[model samples]
Target: MILNGIITGLIMGGILSLPVLGVAVIYGITGIPNFAIGVIGVFGGFLTWYFLSFNMGIAILVGVVFCFAIGYIIQRILLTPISERGGDSTLFFIVTVSLGFVFEGLMRAIFPRPSISLALPRIGTINIAGVTVEGFKIFALLFALGTLVIIRLLEEHTEIGKSWQATSQNLKLAKLIGIKTNRVFSIASGIGCALACVGAIFWGSLYNLNLMTGWDLGFLGFIIAVVGGIGNIWGGIISALIMGMVMSFSGYLLGGMWQSVILYFIVILVLIVAPKGILGSERSL
Candidate 1:
């Protein structure tokens, strides 16, 4: 049972890391808190489910591409202009909340069903010290870790990554040096939402996706990101794993009802003690 809990926690944390990365990446690069990413991701999940009858790979691609487009379009048309107009974090918060609502409505109207479970192929199970775990779950965890490594490499070696770092460090300086800051913001936001969509796909395959799951995911991801140190990618991953353990243990000991309550209470305490976060936002994205 103990081993099971540990594995479960890691899997959960791995799935959650995607959205946490989404929040970290977006906030890191654009300084915008996009509360809508989760909902848009769910919207993409529904799209994948809708197109599942055609082909699995294509459906998944459609979902991810659709989300990327949505994120890109929204950032380009809506958020960037507001940022240019000096919109603060508080304003972005409110705007993104509204955007979430809009996407949620779209999901409801278009999908018809309020809940769905994706039927992804299962890759059997693995036994470790007499504790059996699904192979896909392990894959999810490894995928999460691998993605972080890829992102780190991208930001370190690629031209786009260099531009993202420069723009994030100093927008005016980046713009003066011939970087298209707005385009960078849009692409960053697109990638963030795309990551969230992938998380949603994993979640839907593992359990279920519902109309309200997006809010839960978005809020929880944000909480983990904040506790890990908002805008800090590595910190976000650490925070996600710890919180995943907390949630797993609490759910086992207390019950599902109290799982999130405990997390929120701890988050409050963490914030009170360290106003910034555990790692204090050192190294955004």
Candidate 2:
């Protein structure tokens, strides 16, 4: 039973890390707290589900690319302009939440379904010691970890990634040095939303997706990021793992009602102790 709980916690944490990474990356770079990313991601997840009958690969690609395009366009036309005009974090938060509602309405109107589930293929199962687990769940975990590694490598080796670091560190100085700050922000936003979409895909596959799931995920992701230290990738991952354990054990020992109660209680405690987050932000916003 203990081992089962541990395994469950790890898998849940790994999957949840996807949206946590998304929030971290976006806030880390653009310094914009986009509360809408989860909704946008769910919108893309529904798109993937809609096209699943045709081809899995194509459907996934369509969903991800569509989200990237949406993020790019929104940042380019709306968010960036607002930022340039001296909009603060609070303002961006309000705007992003409004954007989330628009996407949510569009999703309901177009998809015409209040709930959905992705019919992903079963990839067999694996046994760890005496425990058996699904292969797809492992894949989701590894994928999320691999994405972190790739992002780290990108920041270290690539010129574009260097620009991202520079822009993230000091936006005004990056502009002074001839970096396209607006473009950087847009790309970061796009990637963040894309990551969230991928997380949504995995989550919808593992469980059921409903109209409110996006808000749940979006808000959950943000809170996790905050607890882990907003804008800190490593911190976000750590916080997610801790939260996952809390969730698993809470459900195991307590019940569904206590799951969120304990989770939020821990978050509040963490905030009280470390206002910035567990590891603190890489670059304070």
Candidate 3:
């Protein structure tokens, strides 16, 4: 039983890390702590649900597009001004929080605040080395891995990624070098939002969707990002894996409800010790 629980923990940890990875990448590029990312994700999942009620494949496609649109619009309309005005980072944070609340309110107005699991055919669990795992969960983990690989490739191989790297290193320098830094930031924001939506839909299919689900888990992603060290992929993945294990064990030893509270303490500890994150470095973009 103990071994089984640990295996389960590893699986769940990997699954939860998907969104954190996306959140970390977005923050790395834009320096915007998007509190509304989770909201966007959950909403994407809801969009998937609404559409999948008819066709599964179309639902997934729509969820991806929907998330991308939301992220793109928000970046263009809201954050662009603040970035241009050299506004306070605190102001951006406030705006993001407000945006999250607004999304929650809108969701409440349109749908109930209860868990609404999408109706999809459940794949049978796979027994691996005495441990049983759900096929969908495996698919989710693969999807997350694929997304990470593709993003990494884009960052490494493409001209757009070069611009992103330039912007990430130094916004001013990037602009000076003709990278259209603002547009880069905008595009990165859109990409992050879209990625968050993908994570949302994947998780929503595994569980259910609610307005608050995104925001609630958004904080979790934030914690993982912090632990992983901001803007560091390796750190984020490491921290996310550790977080999953910690939460899983906490749930086993304590209670599921207390897992998050404990996780926060762990994050606080990591921050106090290495303020720049465990694997974070001050590298010029």
Candidate 4:
């Protein structure tokens, strides 16, 4: 039972951590708390569902590409302009909150208010060290791990990755060196949104999904990012595991609904203790 609990935590945490990873990347670069990410998750999930209703593979491709485009546009049109004024965090927060409501309403208009589950084929079970692991959970973990690897490689290897790293360290300095800060921001935001999309598709396949589903997930992501330290993607993954474990254990004791309240409380406590987060190197705060 103890081994099962640990394995369950590993599986669940891996699957649920993408949004948090996205938040980490975005916050690390833009230094803005993009509250709209939650909406992006739901939007991506629904879009996937809509497309999959026609064809499966195409749905995944379309969902990823569409979310990336949307994220890019938001960064370019809304976030970039506001952020130039230097106090854009406040404005961005307000805008994202408003956008979340708009997304919720739009989703309600487009799809029924009733929950919809993506009917994916069950893969049954896998024998892992004599422990029976749910195939769906294993698949989700593998998907997330693949995304993480791709992201890590992108950040470390390619020219775009170099530019991103340079820009992240010092935006003004990067611009002075001709790194195209605006484009980098757009790319980072796109990647973040894409990550959310991947996360949503996996999550939606496993459970019932709706417009407001991303609400608590978004908060959970933000908390994981904050606790792990923004701007550090690796830290976000670690923090995600811790946060997931906490929530999972709490749910075992209290109830699922209270898990959210517990997360918020943890976030508040973390903020009071280490305002810059656990592994943050930036002096943004």
In model 2, the number of clashes is: 0
Candidate closer to the true structure by lDDT (higher is better), 1 or 4 = 1
Residue lDDT tens for model 2, 1-285:
788888888888888898889889889998889999999999999999999999999999999999899988999999989988999988998999999999999999999688999999989999999999999998998998999999999999998999999999998899999999899899988998998899999999999788788898899999999999999999999898889888999989998889999999999999999999999977531
* lDDT (tens digit, per residue) of candidate 1 on 38-120: 99888899999999989999999999999999999999999999999999989999999999999999888888699999999
**Rank ordering of all candidates by lDDT, starting from the highest:** 1, 2, 4, 3
User: Model 4: C-alpha RMSD to truth?
Assistant: 2.2
Residue 90 of model 3 has an lDDT of: 91
Between candidates 3 and 4, the one scoring higher on lDDT is 4
User: What TM-scores do the predictions have?
Assistant: 0.98, 0.98, 0.93, 0.92
Candidate 4 lDDT, 74-161, residue by residue in tens: 8999888888977566788898778777877878888754477777778999998889988988888877777778878986898887
Q: Compared with the true structure, what per-residue lDDT tens digits does model 3 show for residues 100-217?
A: 8887777777665457787667788888788788887777777766767887888889998888888888888888878877677677777777777777776677677777789866
In model 2, residue pairs whose N, Cα or C atoms come closer than 3 Å (at least 3 residues apart or on different chains), thus clashing, are none
Tell me the lDDT of model 2 at 124: 100
- Candidate 4 TM-score, true structure as reference: 0.92
Off by over 4 Å in 4: 281-285
